[model samples]
Target: MVDDSLYILEKMRDLNLSVSTQAYNSILYNFRETDEMWDVYKAIESKNEHTYSTVVDGLCRQQKLEDAVSFLRDSEWKDTGPSVVSFNSIMSAYCKLGFVDTAKSFLCTVLKCGLVPSVHSHNILINGLCLAGSIGEALELAGDMSKHGVEPDTVTYNILAKGFHLLGMIKWVWEVIQQMLDKGLTPDVITYTILLCGHCQLGNIDKGLRLLKDMLSRGFELNSVIPCSVMLSGLCKTGRIEEAFSLFYRMKANGVRPDIVAYSIVIHGLCRLGELDLAIWLYDEMCSKRILPNSRTHGAMLLGLCRKGMLLEARALLNSLISTGCTLDIILYNIVIDGYAKSGCIEEALELFRGVIESGITPNVATFNSLIHGYCKTQNIAEARKVLDVIKLYKLVPSVVSYTTLMNAYANCGDTEKVDELRREMKANGISPTNFTYSVIIKGLCIGRKLEKYNQVLRDMASEGVTPDQITYNTVIQHLCRAKDLFRAFELFEEMKSRNLEPTPATYDILINGLCFYGYLKDAERFLCSLRERDVSLSKFAYTTVIKAHCVKGDPEMAVKLFLQVLDRGFDVSVRDYSAVINRLCRRELAKEAKFFFCLMLSRGVSPDLDICRVMIKSSDVLGWTIKAGLLP
Candidate 1:
């Protein structure tokens, strides 16, 4: 674009130039082309603007927008003789296609010139504004363009509409569309698609469908990808899955092959609706149609299969992916691992975790948490601890879910001391307890009969802005009942109701058993009767419990009568029942009755176990009779 002929004629030295001069000229023209760059450098040494602008423009033509921008910026065009237009061309190129952050950096440079921009200048700025999702500012600039004698064209409105859609500013998006229509400007296919897609996105499917039909009637076809893909996504998102599939087939009948993005949306939707078989069929269709999966499609299919708990199928798909040699990213590996882990296949999860590392993909926090949770679910606390160790090695402390999983695992395994230690460790590491952690600890404490510790953890949870869940209250109430803290137990019962958690059978069992063990035989029986009155079935332990209470009160005959009543009700006599009655009879010297029950046990085909045999021997001895206990059984 430079005027080289004028320069060649006006600037010449009288010299007998040789072969090297011709060779150097050829090298400069064919390869280096550095005359403008050299002129710009020398001009900077002497502070010349004309030569510098020339070099910057040449750099821009060569697609070196970055170098031109830096050259203008470092040259300080405003303070020098160079005016604002001196750098406008280079700046415009940058605004159009530069890196997002680099374009942002030019904002200060443009403002420093204290000069009014031209129409082209505003257009460039508008494009950059749209990319940044600054719809308000972009629209303001569009409105103010008349003040600057500049009118927006089709590209201007398209960029603006896309920006509003990106920012979810549908009102403004529609306003822009109306503005385009008022200006008698038939919007391009891109602008129409953005509005059509926006209507579908904001859940006005009727409006969206009407707009699409109207546009079609006006000879506007949804030919390119954005409109097709967005409508496909909207349809799949709603439960109108069959209609969505029909539309896709129709689009293909029009010869517009679906892209990987389109397949991903439909596949993920099918998976979400628990239709894994249909999703797999679509995935196969995608492959058979020769559409290669991008990261989104591949990740969605893997995640969808995993979500359906079809982990073996997911693993097979993953193995096929491996054989085909796709670039396995962290998300893909994590999805596979999470699918297996959530399906309770901790071993498979572990293998995938190692495979990610061995495959040179870095394991992320999600990968670690998935393995930790899987191991915790299976009560393999040691393997969970190993995941924690690996997390430390990777320089990340465990997340709240990680600590909660381990805390519950230890609790489920009856390791109260280890659970407490983990709770303290979680605190020292700056992760406060969550509701799940509180529930698990409270349940463990209740079962361990450590009432003090249970309430203390509850208080800690409240202090940390974590509200106790249903399990927390249920566990506390049950433990209080088991401890025979009758007043405190019922207090917890009322608290549970106030807190909106219904008392479970475990809760009733705890209270009833505690009352029975206290020999409050009438109260215990009333509780069982009350449960029946409320239409809540009395638990098996509840019936056995009142019998235990009767035997405890030196009423073995009544206890035996109660036992027969329990049997008549089809409650099989357990070892505890026989052991209780036999021990009571032997202790009270009812030797004949004890032997009779022993015979009854034989008649019932219930083997008189060791406890029954021992009691029979002692009772026989007390009665001045000799019966070999083994022979009697």
Candidate 2:
């Protein structure tokens, strides 16, 4: 029918009857539907500026950027060629396709053709640069815009603010906002949303709330649900669930009805806070309001239920979704399977795994990893290996997590040979060990007291360009200290500093405790004082170690002084600290002092462990005192 119309139009054109550009554009637009736009363009007799722009813009909107550029370059439109609007269309297309460089080149070509590029042209390139994560280049373009006599608008500033926020250049985000204000542009919803999201991402909930208040004061209506959802999500992430709920209520009171996304955010927050009942209540409330739940909402609720060991409830939720005609995705299956595995119900996990296979869902690596982890948790490494073997039958390659889990099991069992074999198998499968993998192996060797192999592993890790993190160094240092090789531990400690890895509080705790354990009480005290001078917060373990060492060294007087110091400095005194003092006094036959400590321990509500009770009972028996060794009534 279109071909017949085109033939009639051509015959009318040959008869010298003039055809309008609108008539040609109408035909071009129709040809676009059939994707024969170029054929119609060739059939047109009179091609004016409207005809050229119409075809060019239509091609760009259809995402045929190359064809649009070719149409613009065609010699037919050379006499009265493509206009600035046509050029902008092609530039916008290139930018949308993430070819910001190509867009810039096209902009230059427009300039060389004596067409002044508009501010909208510059904004397009700026937005494209921002989307591509080239914030610096985007800013440079903004500068170029001002030099070109094109004023930057709210959109340009908003794009800049969002770009800075995404790059974590949070300081620059504020500066961009200030620049917008300086330009006499009122900050819009997009601007406030960007600021709110930035603060939330950086865990600055207070600042985000302040921005929320500022936005309200500026008289912007709370019509858009996005800002409120972002704020609620931030509050939930920062463990401020009560505050988030309050804000949710506030949003509703202010005439902003909670959408599906808002419901999901609050529900997820409740789930994470372990308020499973509240989460379920919210889920039901949303459904009652006819707000449908998405996969994320279901996933969050299922995870919460499984974590709380409410497997029956979680299964019911899944079945309900299925009954409602919602397709059960593999992620949902993985979540339940992993939850069951972690809860030590390996049989239930296997049952779910089999169910997924029967349901025609091809199990991914995460599915197998969950099952392998379950077997490992039960100390069934052989079964875990069988699961790994089964991956091959399904034509699935085992992930690094698979090898890591099984390697850790063998390492825990002190089977170094199996650990080495798994490592070789991983390498043969083209899986290079990550830093986490090396850390696991090093820790395992340390546990097995294979110090030489541990040192070799460290060297191998360095050769592989995987630097040992604080946890890695701390593990090796702690083991060395346990072996009474304080000298080597100290050397590694110095090496850690040299590598510019600042020692964590755990590192200091290990060193100080190691020093005291090796009978270097004075050195431990001096080191603790130095750490205090450097403003490094000492752990209670450090203080308790010194106290225990003092008590063992038979200096009860010094131990008592340190105990008072710990109290004065506001350090937590554990039951172990009280027990050490009591045990020492009992060994010295000082029943009165020992009984006093026992009484103090009870007063603090720290229930004495069996070790504490046993020593106190023996002292009471020997001294002939009828004092209770259990809780003092």
Candidate 3:
């Protein structure tokens, strides 16, 4: 289009025809992005107000604010002084580029030139302020609009409401809506959509629903599916998938055919809830409705399939998309590649990686990292290192995840030298070690049983300003417990508290189990009781650990009592916990107690495993009762 305009302008000049200023202005506007616009401007026989405004608008559109301002100031050279439209062009461009203050300063220039500001001019400044999160300034500007003889329009109020919504000031958003109502300005669909979205974002789905109903009753046209999509997303985000599904159906029933975005929201929600079957059903429904799914929809399905370890299905879907000439995004490829890697399918992952490169899709850091992880998982460190080299070859910098994955692999192999080299290389690359990196190193030290080297790593962590989290402290403590250095383990536990890291239930489970293993049953009991007294929420495993310990100490009654306590606390009992108590009771020849506990296990919906079944069978046969007669009821 620009070339055609340039050619016509050249031909007109060759024919010696007098070119109109309007023709030059038109060419300048169309060819603004190109250097030819300046050539056209220079060839103008006489410039008019339109020509000057066109030039200023062009310069402003190009983000050359200073040049646009210069042209606006020099308009008098062409016998046309600056106008409000010219100033507005510069202000609009400045506001778009986030120069709200600069745009605001130009308002005085508009007034100084004896040109009243238009509603558009005020709206532009108001929007810029709102977008810059200067909501207070935006409100002040809107209030000043009336003083400037420019009343705030719907766009003005909408921008302010949106700004307040973005800042999560929903009350302020409501106030803005109220102001619109008080001013006798009827709220439009956009105003209602913003209000609906604000409520949905705040997890007030019910309130949003009420607003939607009100919108419907008022006959407000919701031509777009954005409001419904917002509601669906909020419902799904808050784990209200069933409500989202109902809303999905309600949308269709109300003749608001769900668009691709709406379908994607519900589909992603279902996938997140592990309801793959339902998600696929909805995907099929979307296809049948002829609402084509985009990359996000396909990506959500692929993720759901990958999570279920159904790689073949996910790959088939990928192939189908590719066969249909769908240009899949790198994100989808990363998902499949990472899935294959995590599932120990290194060869398949590498194959896909090659295919991505061959298909002209540049592999990202995540792509290379997945392959590296794949190789590391298969104990193919050499291949993993080659993947790192490939990362550099592709000019993509390795992320902290890349270095940490390799370091973890080396740590697993007990190769501290390789781990140290990777750490140094990471530092050289200007990548600061994250907490995960320190945790990996600490875990590696524990795995290698290099107990004496812990102090150095701890000191290194401190020097690096990396505070050890609960997981790191737990790792060190578990190792110490395994080594029977209970004193040191307890000391580390205290250190974790001093460092303000609250030990999780997993920590207690590890400690109690370790105490039981080391024949410190009494200590384990005391610790459990102390925690219970403190009202610290303990895992059922903690109680079960002590129960198993009491049984090992030949105190069947105490084990039974602890098992009852586990049930009384409303902690969901696992099969292992039930089996531990039942097995001990059966072995102690307390068949009636064992039968009662077995019945309770079944009543509690805890399925007994084969090991527990065998224990019961053996005990029933010795007790001279049929298996069903013993506990099946």
Candidate 4:
């Protein structure tokens, strides 16, 4: 119908009737909705400023920015071309698209055209710069505004405050707020909200509450829930969930209804605090209120339930959502699949994966990755490989996680060749190995006793800018200690410390075991003492190593002392611990002392193993034979 009307209007114009600019604009507006701008341009008998402005503004709104610029530059209006309004339209479009640098460059064109940029023009460019993370450049532009006779308004200050907030420059945001107040420009709700969110993000919930109070005192009603939501989120983040819940109820009591966002915040807080029962209650309460849950709310509840090992309840919740005609997004599916996989319910996870495909929601790499992880956990490598093959069948690009999971599985099985092949394939697919990938490969090589490959892996990790984490360092150090390369192990340990990686208990265990095995009793004992001095919790393994070392060094008395110390320190003394002490005393021809330990072991309800009995019998003492014959206790 519009096309026919345009045709009739064009015919009327052909009959020497004057077609107004308003008629041209009307036709252009209709043409803009479709891709028939050329027809409208041809229908206009004489194009004027209104015709050009309407076309340019419509093009800008549609985000056909290049076409808008081309029309402004080379159209019939080019000679008597674009007004300030037309220029502002294009600049605002650029800013809206987050191309602040391009918008800034276009400001020069406005100056070259002798058109003074308006305050709105400055604000648009300033916002673009702020969003681009160029806060300094934004500030300079704001200063330039004053020079150009354009004073900053509340919008300008609000943009500056938000930019500074994003940069984590909370102090600078306060300065902007103060400047707004000094300029006699009252900070609006947006200004206050930005400040509130900033303080909340900085974990200054007290200051955020004060800001809330100030906003309320300034005649801004608690009509907007955003400020309350920000404060609630802040409280929850700082572990003040109780306070957040109080505020949530207060908002409702004050006649300010909580939205889905507000409800999600409180729900997440409850989940974090392990109050899942209350979280479920809140979910049911929201339903009773007819406030429908969104993806975020559902996801929070699903994750909370899954974390609590309530997989069955989580599945029921998902079913309820589906029954209510709510579409489940990929994220929700992935969360549930991962939850099932982690819970050792691989069959259920795979069934859900099939449901995803049947529902026409294409399973992503995460879905397959979860299945692969589940299979790997059960050591079903063949099934995991089938999932990897399915990834290619679906024509989906496997993520780094996909490759790393399979690589770790094969590495754990000591299939180094397969691990290498997967690493090559991952790189061929343009996926760089992350720290986790290198950690897995390095650990595999260590376990396979391919210690010579450590340097190459370390070099590759460095060249790829992937720093080895604590696990990687521990793996290397343990391998070195097992090989009896104590010096190298110590050097790596020192290097780990220098790099700020704290040594774990496993690290100390490996070192102590290696030290005792090599008969370095003195160094091993000193290291254990140093650990105690440093308040490091000594493991039972550490004490056992030192006890065995003392026995190896022909110090039966010292060995007994260490054994007694182990008991006094509350470390569970193993049978091997008792056997080591008894065997040492028997070897030293202290049959009476050995018998005393044997009787003590029996009295403590620890039945000695055959090794301990043989050691006592080999001493050829009648008491040992009598004890073995159950004639002595």
Q: In model 2, which runs have C-alpha deviations exceeding 4 angstroms?
A: 1-151, 164-187, 204-224, 253-256, 345-365, 382-407, 414-439, 451-633
RMSD of 1: 16.3
Tell me, by TM-score, which candidate is best: 3
Q: What is the C-alpha RMSD of each candidate to the true structure, in Å?
A: 16.3, 10.1, 9.8, 12.7
Score candidate 4 by TM-score against the native.
Answer: 0.56
Q: What is the C-alpha lDDT of each candidate?
A: 0.71, 0.85, 0.85, 0.84
Residue-wise lDDT of candidate 1 within 1-633, one digit each (tens)? 235632442343234323233322332333223544453243232334554556566676677777776777676555564444545666666655644445545545555665556666666777777776676777788888888666887778887887888888888888888888899888877887888878888887667667665665666554655566777777777766776787677777766677888788888778767787898899898999898877778778787878878788888888888888866778878888888777788888888888887888877777898898888777678988888889989987788788777777777666789888988888899887777778888776766656567556656777788876656766676666656678888887778879886677667777888787766778887877787678775556766677666655666676676666667767666666677766776777766666666666666767767766667766676223324333543
Give every collision pair in model 2: none
Query: Candidate 3: where is the Cα deviation over 4 Å?
Result: 1-293, 451-455, 529-540, 555-633
Ranking by TM-score: 3, 2, 4, 1
Q: Provide the lDDT at 610 for model 2.
A: 80
User: Model 3 Cα RMSD, Å?
Assistant: 9.8
Candidate 1 colliding pairs: none
Ranking by lDDT: 3, 2, 4, 1
TM-score of 1: 0.49
Q: Which portions of model 4 miss their true places by more than 4 Å? A: 1-115, 119-266, 269-275, 281-292, 386-389, 392-395, 477-493, 502-633
In model 3, state the lDDT of residue 275. Answer: 90
